[model samples]
Target: MASDSYDFIIVGGGTAGLAVAARLSEDPSQRVLVLEAGHDAHSDPRIKTPASWLSLLGTDVDWNFRSEPQPLLDDRVISLNQGKVLGGSSATNAQVFVPPATAVVDHWENTLGNASWNWETLRPYFAKAYTSPPVDGTMAETLGIDGWTETSTTHGPVRTAFPGDQSHPIRKIWADTFRATGHYMAKDPFVGSTVGSFTALASVDPATGERSHSAAAYYYPIKTRENLHVITNATVEKVSLNRHGLNHVTAKATGVLYHCGDEIKEVTCEKEVILAAGALQSPKILELSGIGNADLLRQHEIDPIIDLPGVGENLYDHIMCSISFAAVDELETLDAIFRQEPDALEDAAKRYAKDGSGPFSSMGVYSYAYLPVLKHASPEGRQKLIELLEEARPTKGDTPEHARAQAYYEIAKASLLDPKQPSCAYLAFIAQFVGAFESNTKSFTISAMHSQPLSRGSVHIQSKSVATAPKLDPKYLSNPLDLEIFAANLLQIETIIRTSPLSTLIKQPIVHRDPASNLTDLDSAKNWIRKNGDSMWHYGGSCAMLAREMNGVVDEKLKVYGVENLRVVDASAIPIISTANIQATVYAFAERAADLIKESHGLKAAGA
Candidate 1:
């Protein structure tokens, strides 16, 4: 028989939840209960193997959530695949552990109303979340790793190291191409403000070459602890709160009403009810608990607990579009393996069966860059960007909405124009990665992503059911500025394709993987981007941490406003998107959030 109560109840055991649970349970005096919608999946091989991450999509471990038809992208309903299993999206995402720009983190404190959330304050947490492996001398010089003054940090739970065949030419070619273009990073990417091209580390551990994620790093090590109780396949329907109407004392969240096994169950908590159910679902859970907009709650007959209008607003994601070019005939790419050629599969399997080292150990996406579009753009393109910047300038007024709009626009505009700031993140993959289908031609791709977007969208409950996913509308490229940003990036990518070292690797008279991506002019590129652009699954900002006057749902401490002992600890609380892959930021944020929770309850702080 399970206990009826615990010191803390975490709803949705994902990336952030498990990290908090592990930290809290360390005290041994407090009982921590985690209610996970998905089952424990540490034993799943698809998740364990580094390169087999792509096979896990649409499986039981994936939420497989799709967005509402986006009108801007030819009415395409883009797939937003989130992890359903323990460790959450960290287990399923591409194993890139890149950090965001320091300036962007500072914006959370300086511009946005989040106190103590600046770069200097949160910088240490990034080092605390993941450890960088020791890089060899020769590989170091080739990767510009020699330029790093010192190793950023030595130790942390989420293990990270460079994976794949270390001798792979793509690594050298990528670094040299950026060096030739004079965009190689000036400083260690993790030390301070990150800019320029880098050979980013993967989440795969050096010891076994398996994916090192939140579950494997945090949960598995502490699973045997008596104070921690984790219940799998437990879907929390709503947070049980003492609703005394909107104007009365804040409703106190006491527990969660969940579905487990064959019966509906109730689990009470004495301290706090934390929501770590990602960006899309956390807002849905809050709305389901009647802590959202009163009018929206009333439509589903859910009596309002708090009138927070920001529960499902400010939703945004990294919009990405790729342009792939065929590699030279002599170049060895992932084409044979991706195509499932019989001999190739047999050879790879034999190698993997021997020592867990083979094609199954790498994703071949180690090369990456963060570039400002204008710096690489043509002279005419540069003038067009200046004009666009003026046209898209946001006006701030008295309303909180206006304040948020202006703040985000100014930050984005500065990033877009400033040569020191990264406007787009480019991934160079050793495969034909333009579209879904396997290609007969051997090719490589450079995928460009709009890191910080000006456009905002929403994720709201269609009904009061927790089983149903919220209606997600990212409103991709709805803002004309986003379209122009994509166009500018496309022009830059064209220039990169013609540049020296990278250009030398490609086949003569380049062949594009997708016909639509064969760029001719600005108009054609814009049209192609609209047809092809999609989310990178780095969604956040629905339940943002800002001043309540700015329509923020959570306070700086991650506590829900007007709600007692209730908090949201997930990507949803991030006021805006980061500059690169957000896994590192999420881990660091979770680490800091754990300490904040401990401080609130007079518990032993975990490495704060």
Candidate 2:
């Protein structure tokens, strides 16, 4: 092989890209190169501090792409913030490390027709991706009861730790408030049954109190290897492919053409070319490479190589809205430190610098709760919701894409209606507004998120240029089921606030009308949600992993349909959205993909 060629070429050195590259480079003979569109910012303080995560948004490190004005949200053009740095969104996201519910993973396997993708099979990959700190006797008992086995924190590269004594005092108050409201006391969130309120763990190095991103945890340690080559600030324009000789007419990916500085360069891959460019960019790259819909390609004046219609369809994300209340007492919030009290901000900085122990070490979200709307609703309300869901169910359409969407809708409906499964809404309590809303006084924010939304959207190339971002439309609140779920959760929030311990602390609802105002009316609450809702930043399924007959871009092995030596190993490949933050699941996906790639090439799997 030439100097510019490698055994494998992984595009987008973000979360999954770095993980796949790190695992592949374990073999001494296999050469791997990672092409990242953004610069490496592993040492930047803004990325290291958890409290500074919000600051990274709209900055140069952020892709800062905006969606086409969504029709449902009053035609609002929502900002789709994706990390442009090496670690991708994992570096810039709220470091909450909750795993997907077991039922959600089962849904993916059933939908994709891949039994190996179930929770039990992917569990080892999850353990391989991160190392959690040792749980004490009490915590161990809790985890054991929840069926969570211990992960090796001492040996694994990515570090994960609990807040322990460093957590805010308000966490207890939030947890107690949920308990008072009849929500169950959640155990370990990593055990795939996070159906109650609990103080969640974070992807942070407890010893240093810094964000444990993919770059810091997965890439940095192994970057010195001679077999691994990483190019920063390089954008892959399109993959280069050649038609298979004689028998087969389909083009097989051979290399990648990317922009490095002002120079356009091409690098060949002897074995495979993997795409980890995330949900938004991966589909664009595929379409740009002439691997998408034939008509769509011809419209942009690009010659079609393969007509894979599923390249950019089936996009969905978790929609969230913050219901905030002004804190009546002297309870401290991140708003007080970051926006109001300069002295407190300076003190926190000093403390963080000295011992890595302070409010600055965490992303303000202390605890979270996942509740089924039916569980909290009256018998009549449950029946009403079921009726609404059935009415809103997508009818089978003419196209394969439409049928795929309908299938997904059915899965979402089943999950949401099943009381034994995890809830459709996730509630996270923040001591302060955390910049979600503007308030003059210190405030507490409860983020109500519709986890399993029936609404679907897309990301597609507006032009042939890779520099131009794809048009993103998450189509939030388009489904009536989503609105109903959000409304139910908002009512649940109001119920908690109107109760004892929390009610005494809250002064008034800052964002909505008033603290004491009755927001239980479904119509009024739905209106409030429409005006205030935003994405939870968990985007996926732009290039879904499902059966090819269902318009899936990738197969069970994560291989792209109608193409050879190509795979999508990022959030885009996920068939369904998880019940929690998606970072943990993305890491596990990469870990499993690496093993699959290795096994296919007659190489030993990682840890084998």
Candidate 3:
């Protein structure tokens, strides 16, 4: 290894890696090395388009880790999709650029004991990571200034609009009708008061409508910088720990250790190594380096250096079930209608690639809906539903856990006799089973998420091999309250869908499936759907930032405990998931992490 040294070596050149590299390299005196396990920033076209999200799955750009069969969903194994590309998942996501509610942050700071993790301090970083363009005077009023990632309503060549769709009119009607029911419309959902419906924007360049990903804004700008080296197609095997007795320790980051292009060579980090390998890999890196819980380490027959029991505990994520509708016409696919049509998808993509305008630029969410289940339901009612879901969820495998999911599904279906009460059956009707939208008649997917999930899961190293993916435990619907919340949210969806103005677009009613009798009962259908729901793929919190006693992996600043010079700066550092899209929050966390790293290392500030 001729090149074995740098001031800072960042593993995983995805969203967090690039952001930290860019900010660190702003000082020419600081040398930064970014090693990516995947390919370069601009190598793939599928990652560039918003509609290409589904295609990015199962590719080299995706880690594609699978979860242990969930205890709740019939012991089903869920696919965990984390980005492996330059910009990471942000490069291959829906590009929805909305932030979490301020309350979410307040909760993290107050409840999680990370005092520096409040929204007031974080707001500036959010502004710095985005370039908010003016939108009907809303941009000036809503978007915060002073950010690196640009945002705007200028839907570029890739932008698409849905005004004439049957769902479009109904969405507005529902918004107004919901407002009459006491819900308020939010002009800026990111600032955190998300009590109502509002359009969301993403990091789309106003001039080109193309996304302003971390790679584009950070890595691409410094491609030729001699002091900075970004090596793609390289995998990190493990962190080499130099443990001095029981107290002192140092690490050597073995980089690009995996085979690539018929060649595999070992690269070492001479300077300090930073594990931005994300929540999943970061812990595995530490575990493979002889860190992690003593009991677990001994079980694996590995010597424990750090003995950090919190290495993979306190894992939390927003597991969601995406309820999708079948399109009324075959022309409803974004490809058939938008791409194949004369000036349809072309106009959007071209505008985005050229000057950053069009429908492709905006966050593609039809509307964000929040329904508080316990807010209106009785304590007993909520408790009973929670108990049922807890009993039903399959926790282990088909052996014992499988029986639970089945039994819970049955009891849950039987509990939804009261149509007026809040329940999962209702949520199914609104989220996935509801009738098709107008104009196109295509089905819509309303994701039923565990907003404040109680279930904790994790990812750990099964081996020291870099070629292997980590063992993941999402533990979906582990907490009884989570299932109840999902059930309640499902009911909310059903309620809105059944309402007058919104129901006008639904030519057909929502269909519910019953497994036992194999018949349709609207109430029980919701319960069945809940049992079979899938993950939203927003797995996070593996390296959660919490108090030391709680076995917190990282501090408020995202610095890994027991490590002198390392940190995990991504969704993994997020103590909790935001109410909105995770991308913008991830960007903000990266931006904040960049600043924190700079201050800690005594680097020059931005523009200095």
Which candidate has the highest TM-score of all?
A: 1
For model 1 the local lDDT of residue 578 reads 88
Tens digits of per-residue lDDT for model 3 on 15-127?
A: 77888788787888777788888787574657655445667888888888888888677788887787888877777776666666665676567666787888888877776
Please give, for residues 254-346, the per-residue lDDT of candidate 2 as tens digits.
999999789999999999999999999999999999999899999998888888888888898988776667676576666655564678788
Give candidate 1 regions above 4 Å deviation. Answer: 142-144, 244-249, 375-383, 395-397, 435-440, 605-608
Which pairs of residues clash in candidate 2, taking residues 3 or more apart in a chain or in different chains? 509-515
Candidate 1, TM-score vs. the true structure? Answer: 0.96
TM-score of each: 0.96, 0.93, 0.78
In candidate 1, the residue pairs with backbone N, CA or C atoms under 3 Å apart (3 or more residues apart, or in different chains) clash, namely none
The local lDDT score (0 to 100) that residue 34 gets in candidate 2 is 94
For residues 1-608, could you state the per-residue lDDT of candidate 1 as single tens digits?
26989999998788888888888898978899998889888988889887778888889999999999999899999999999998899889889888898889988998886999998998888887887887778787665465556458648888887777777777777777887878877566888756678778888887788899998998998799898999999898999999665567588999999998779999899999999999989999999998899999999999997889989999989988888888887766777787788987788777766776778777778778888875446677667778898898877489878877888887887676667888889988887877546546678888889887888999999998777788999998877898877777776787888788888879889777777888877798889877888889999999999888889999999999999889988999999898978998888898899889999999984343
